[model samples]
Target chain A: MHEMGIAQQLVQIAIDSIPRDIENPKVEKLNLRIGRLASVVEHSLTFCFEIITKDTPLENARLDIDVVPVTVHCKSCDNGWEVTGPVFKCPFCEDGDVEMLTGREIEITSLELADELKI
Target chain B: MEINIQKKVLEANDTEADINRTFFKDQNVFVLNMMSSPGSGKTQILCKTLAKLMPHVRVGVIVGDICTTNDADRLKVTGAKVTQINTDQFGGDCHLAANLIIESAKQLGCEDLDLLIVENIGNLVCPAEFDIGEDARAVVLSVTEGEDKPLKYPLMFRVADVAILNKIDLLPYLDFDAKLVVDNMKQVHPHLPVFEFSAKTEEGLEPWLDWLKIKVFEKTGK
Candidate 1:
C-alpha cells in the first residue's frame, strides 16, 4: 500500500533530523499530526514504520499520530464547525456551499530523542 | 534536549512534486493525473479520449500498475507514446509518486508533447493521498461503484479538479441514479466539475474533450 511509501518517508525524515554531533542518538517517539481527510490508516502506517525502521536509526521510534478533525467554514453563516462524521452541510444554516478549513494535513509536529545535545 | 523539528514527514515527496511541476511548465505539457478504483474504465476512457485528441495534440502516457503492462499495451493502440511503470519493482506501491513520474516521463520522452497523462494505480484511498505533479486531477467514478463513494472517500473527491461519472450508458439497465451521485459529489466539493459520460458509447464526451482541448491550448498556446 501507499502507507509503505509514507512510512518510508517518515522514517527517512526522522533519521535525517537527528543531530550530527550527538553520538548514537536514538529516537524515542515521533509526534505526527494527521488530518481526518488524509485517508491514512494509522495501524497500517505504524506497522509499515516498524518494519521499515528495523535496520535504521529509527528502530525504536514510536509513531504517535494525532488525528485532527475535519473542519468546514460556512460562507453564508460565517461560522466554522468540526465535522464529526460525513456531514458536510453547515450545521447552523444547512448551507452546502461551505469551504473546508482544515483536515487535510499530514505532517510531523515534533520528535523525542534519547540523548540531548549538550550546549 | 527537546529539539523541535516541526517538519512534514512527506516534505521530500512534496519538493519532488514541485520540481516535476516546474518541468511540466517549462516543457509546456499539460499533465493530467487520472485516479480511480480498479475496473472503473480509466484505460478505456483514455483510449477513447486520446483517439479523439491525437490528431490535434501530441499526447504521452505514463501508466502505473502493481505488475502489469496490460494497460500500456491497450493504450498503445491509440497511437500515443505509452510508458509503463510496474510498481512491483518498488515493493508494489499502490500509487505513483513524483519521483516515479519523473523517471517514467524520461522514459516516455516529454519533449514535443502537448499533454501527458499519468494513469495512477487503481485504488480510491491511497492514490488520493499523493500529489504526483499533475496540472489537473480527475477522479473516475463508475455507476456500479455506488453513489456514496464520494461521502466515504471525501479526500479523493475534495482534491479532484474534475470527476468523470463513467458508464452512463449502463444507467438505463441499472438502478443507479446519476443525479444522486452528482449531488453526493457536490456535498463533498460543491464546485467540483463533474462530467457524466460513457467511454463505451461515447455518449457525453464532447464537453470533457472540449474542456481538455481548451486546457491544453491554454497551457501551450497552440
Candidate 2:
C-alpha cells in the first residue's frame, strides 16, 4: 500500500530533523495534518507507521492525526461550504464547478520530542 | 524541544528531480509521465502511439509495475526501446519517484532517445503527487471505470495536462456518460485537453497522435 511508503517517508523526515546534540531523541508524538481528499487511509497509515518505527528512535511515538474536511468556495453564489462526503458540490448554489479551497494536504505538521531536561 | 519544521518532506526527492529536469533539457528529450488505474489500457495506448510515431520519431519507454514485465512485453511488439522497473521488490511502490526514474533513465540509454514515456504503476492518487521531471503528465481514464472518476480522483485530473478517455469502443455496451467525465474534468482543470479514443480499435486516436506530434515538435523543434 502507498501508506507504507508514506509512513517510511514520515519516519525518515523525523529522523533527519533530529538535532545532532541529542544522542537518541525518543519521539513522543508525531503531528500530521492530512486532508480528507488526500487519498490516504488514516488507519492504514497508522498501522504502517507502527511497523516501520519499531526498531528506530521513534519506537513508541504516538501518531496524532487531524483529518481535515474538504472546503469548497462557490463562484456562482459566493459562498463557502464544507464538503462532508465524496461529492464536492456547493450546498448553497448546487454548483459542481466550485473551487476547492482545501482538503488535498498530506504533511507532517509538527513533532513532539521528549524533554531532555525532565529526563 | 519541539521543532516546528515546516519543510517539505519530499525536498530531497525534489532536488533529485531538478537534476533530472536539467538532464532531459540537455538531451532535448520530451518525457511524459503516464498515470492511470490498473487495466486502463496504458500499455495499449503506448503500443498504438508507438506504431504511429516510430517511423518518424525516436521513442522509448520506462514501464513501472508491481511485479511482471507484461506491459513491457506488450510494448516490445511495437519495436520501441522499452525497459521495465519491477517495484515489487521495493515494497510494491504505487508510483515511480524521481530517483527511481533517474535510475531507470541510466538503463534506458537516454542518449539515443527523443521521447521517453514512463508508464507509472497502476494507481491514480499517489502517482499524481510525485513529480518525475516529466514535460507533461497525462491521466488515462477508461469508460468502464465510470464517469464519476474525475470527481473522485480530482487531484489526478487537476494535475494532468492531458486527459485521455480511453476504451471508447466499449462505450456502446456500457451506460457511461462521457460528457459527465468531460464536465467534471473541466470543473477541476478548466482548460485541460481531453482526447477520447480506443487503443484497441484505433478509433479516435488520430487527434491524440497529432497532439503528441505537435508536443514533440514544440519541445525538440525536429
Candidate 3:
C-alpha cells in the first residue's frame, strides 16, 4: 500500500523537524487530516508508521487522524453542502456542475513533541 | 511542545509533479495519464491509439508496472519511443508517482515529442491518488466490470477529465448497461465526458482519437 510510502515520508519529516538545540526529541503524536476520499486507511497507516519509526526518533509517535468530510458547491445554483455519499450533485438544484471546496486533504497539520520537547 | 508543520505528507510528490508540469509546458508536449482497473483494456486501447497516431504525432510512452514489461513490450511494437518503469524496489508500487514519470520522460528524452502518454499501473484506487503532471487524465472502464464501479471508486472518476468505456462491442453479448454506467459516472463526476468504444474492434474510437489529437495539437501544435 501507499501508506508505507506516506509513513516513510512522515517519519523523515518528523525527524527533520526536531529542534536543533534539543539533545533528543521524541514525537508523541502525529496529527493528520485525511479526507474521506483519500486512499489511506487509518489503521493501515498507523501500522506502517509503527514499523517505519521503530529505529527513528518517532518510534513512540501515534497518528491522530481526522477524517475530513467531502464538501462541494454548486456552480450553477450556488448551493453548497457536505457530501456524505458518492454523488456530488447539489441537493437543492440537482445540478452536477459543482465545485469541490474541501475533503481532499492528506496533510500533517502538526506534531506533538514528548512533553515540552525534552528528552 | 507542539510543532505546526501544515505540510502535505506527499509534498515531495506534489513538488515534483509541478516541476514535471512546467517541463511539459515548456517543451510543448501533451501528456495524458491513463488509469483503470486491471484487464480493462488500457494496454489494448493504448496500442490502438499508438497505431492511429504514430507518424502523425511523435508520441512517447512511459509505461508503469510492478515487475513485468509486457505492456511496454507491446506498446513498443508501434514504433513509438517507450520506456517502462518497474516498481519492484518500492515493493511493487501500486501507482506511478510524479518523480517516476519524470524519470521515464528523461530516459526517453522529452524533445521532439508532441505527446507523452503514461500508462499508469492498473488499479483504480491508487493511481488516481497520485498526480503525474499530465495535461489530461483518462479512466478506462470496461463494461465487464461491475456497473457500480463509479460509485465505488469516486475519486478515480471525479478527477478524470474523460472516461473511456472500453469493450463496447461486448455490450450486445453481456448484460452491461452502457446508459446506466454513464449515469453512474455522471452522478459521481458531473460533466465528465464518457467515450464508449471497443478497443478490440476499433469501433467508436475515432472520437477518442480526435480528442487526443486535439489535445496534442492544442498544446504542441502537432
Q: Give me the candidate number with maximum TM-score.
A: 3
Model 3, B105-157: lDDT tens digits are 98898898999999999899998888888999999999999999999999999
TM-score computed on alpha carbons, candidate 3: 0.97
lDDT of 1 at B202: 97
lDDT-superior candidate, 2 or 3: 3
For DockQ, the strongest prediction is 3
Q: Output the TM-score of candidate 2.
A: 0.88
Candidate 1 error regions (>4 Å): A74-78, A87-98, A115-119
Q: In what order do the candidates fall by TM-score, top score first? A: 3, 1, 2
lDDT digits (tens) for residues A24-111 of candidate 3: 6778898989999998988889898889888777897889999999999898888789999999766787754888888889998898
The lDDT ranking, best first, is 3, 1, 2
- Residue B41 in model 3: lDDT: 98
Worst 10 residues of 3 chain A by lDDT: A110-119
Candidate 1 residue pairs that clash:
none
